[model samples]
Target: MPNTTQNAPTNVEEIATSMQDTVLGIWADFVNHSPFLVMGALILLFTWGISALAARLMDASLRHSKMRGSLRELFVRLLSIGIWITGILLAAMVTFPGLTPARALSAMGIVSIAVGFAFKDIFENFFAGILLLWRFPFEKGDFIECEGISGQVEHISVRQTLIRQTSGELVIAPNSFLFLNPTKVLTNLPRRRITIITGIAYGENVTEAVRVIEHAVDECRTVHKDRPLEIFPQAFGASSIDIEVTWWADPTPVDVRRSRGEVVTAIKGALDEAGIEIPFPYRTLTFKHPLETVSLEKSEGEIS
Candidate 1:
């Protein structure tokens, strides 16, 4: 054993030689396996082409089936993404025979955790968006009120929903928040109620004022015949009596505010023409301790 060292290469030289052999062997194998590698690449390309075509066809079929326009787009995008991801995974496996799904998934775990933590809100919104697309609680062009914000749905995306309010303000709401809250879709029904309050001088024929309001409701152009219109005296107050008129109307074909404005205007005009007093606020002032002096001064001003 002591004499063997005298003719043997050093450890460093041996390591270098071993590395060279390994490199040469790897090169030889790669050169010999070129055809197989090329064939695998071709197969992967073919699979990708097929996947793309299949995804397109599926999307077309879904659209043709009369799915909600926004939902259809979302579904098609998700479908295409799934197909491409599948094709990519398959191609990666073909390129590397030892690339196991378990290993790949394990490698992604840490990165996925980081991504999830970094974009928690976005992920929530994305999932909520998917739910919205599938459930279709409302659609584009629908007038919706959510969390006290009322607007027409302008756009729906993977993260947020955009609405344009009647006041010309743009509201951007997170899909997650919208889904978690209560939403009222006004357009789901064909008609809505218009409630108006009018006042008449106190003790001046509450019954007659109510009749006038009823006449106004009946004659209003916006009133729906299918739903009954009503007018009744609500209360007697110090200055006036209040009459409430409630009517149903079709809100689909016209602007709600404008239609309501027209009805109110017509009712007020009708009342004015009929000489039924739509009273405003008035207060009677009286002096207690200084009544005599105030009366004398008021009489003096009137005389002047």
Candidate 2:
């Protein structure tokens, strides 16, 4: 510290000189190591190209296999993922010849664990969605009731299933829940039976009412003629005779519901046109207590 030389370079000048020497050293190393560097680069490039080409070919082949829609989509995604992962690993090995895949994977284990834990739910959903897509428990345009909601399936994707209800509401349900829970597919059968309950006056003939219902069912356009429709007397109520009419519909729930509405309206109109009396409950009130009887009398008087 006591020695002073004006000719000695300042700290800034010394740092600048050291930087220049470091740059020259790096350039020399690069020139000397060109072969290895070029070789690694070329290997990586070749691996990437091959992986991309293989993934495309596999996807095309799977699409042509005429497999189920869900299975085809899943196979394509899985094949592409596998190819890219393998290619990246190969590229990493080529970039660092001394580093093995085992070592690299081991080093990355902790980070992978942390990431997995952080996104565990997301991973669960993703895997469950893949399973659902592959297995295809349900398909597009199927009438399914799940998670306390009943609707026709509009679309299905990896994350959620879209459903449109008769009330004009769109429901988006998670694929994971659909995969885990029970799903009711109404459209699985070629046709579904529609049940309608109608009542007639107390004195009306039960047999005649059943005949009228049968005629109405046959006349309704929604009723499939291929399937025999059933109309019969079910029970004799206190004030009316209950008649049941059932018909088959080929469409999904929404269509069935619409057709059912039309059929019921037509049946009711036909019954009314035929002078069939549909009765409601007619009750005669008897007073249980004296005070209740007096209140009823007073209310009727006040209304008058």
Candidate 3:
């Protein structure tokens, strides 16, 4: 037996009818607001186009300026960000006619603290990057050593810097880390001084050794002739006395390496040609009573 009541709808039917009505209501609202929505979207698209055009124009206008390439890029990026932020606010207001400036300000104020906490590191890095671009000594293509990482700076962005190491590895370092740490810019000058230690036998003439080293290092192709070479007896060791050889070379890693090799080879060859001895570790042991001597004396006594 089945009981049916036409006046009462089942729960399932009621739920479906409610959903249908809700969807139709939403469709009607969308239709009524389609024009404003389209206008908002078009405004955003136009803003994007303008932002891009302005970036190009700014880059071209400042191409010949004295500002650094990274600084120029920063300016372009900031301009784009400003334009987009304005565009978004305009679009939102147009999309929602009821969202007034005062209401927007209230909403932003409510979330300001939370947003700041959430993006604290992001903002810190952004400001640090700006400082680095504005007045920091090192720039793109400059080799810098910060903390334990050292490499040539490839790019500087709002949040991080890309360093390309001599070994071909790329390191992404935060701008804050670079900003806070002590950075040594190896390429700050066109040339930098490099020192290497070499040793000679105790018997070698100190004056002759110094003279030979100076001549050899100076003859190297990469040695900066304008800068004076320094060769001095640095310290005395167990095996030999260490000679500190210092000269100026090009500040690039490859140039420094090549110059070092050349200097070392020249020193070794010069020392060897001059009949000077390079020191090596050696040990001389004198036993109080050698076994061979004792045995021989005992045999002689037995024979006697």
Best by TM-score: 3
- The regions of model 2 sitting more than 4 angstroms off are 1-66, 105-111, 148-154, 164-172, 226-228, 235-239, 287-304
- Local distance difference test, per candidate? 0.80, 0.79, 0.90
* Candidate 2 per-residue lDDT over residues 193-246, each given as its tens digit: 888888899877777777777887788777789998888788877778888888
Worst 10-residue lDDT window for candidate 2 reads: 1-10
- How do all the candidates rank in terms of TM-score, highest first? 3, 1, 2
Q: lDDT for model 3, please.
A: 0.90
In order, how many clashes per candidate? 0, 0, 0
Q: Which candidate do you rate higher for lDDT, 1 or 2?
A: 1
Error of 3 at 43 (Å): 1.3
Worst 10 residues of 1 by lDDT: 250-259
Looking at candidate 1, what is the lDDT of residue 12?
A: 68
Clashing pairs in 1: none
Tens-digit lDDT string for candidate 3 (139-249): 899999999898999989888999999999999999999999889999999999999999999999989999988888888999999998999999987788899999999
lDDT, candidate 1, 1-304, per-residue tens: 3766754667768899999999999999999877768867887787678767876787779876867787786877687667766666666666677988877666568777999999999999999998887888888898888888988899988789998997899999999988999998888777887787778887567777777777777876767789988887887766788778788886543556666787788878877877888777888898676644458888899999
Better of 1 and 2 by TM-score: 1
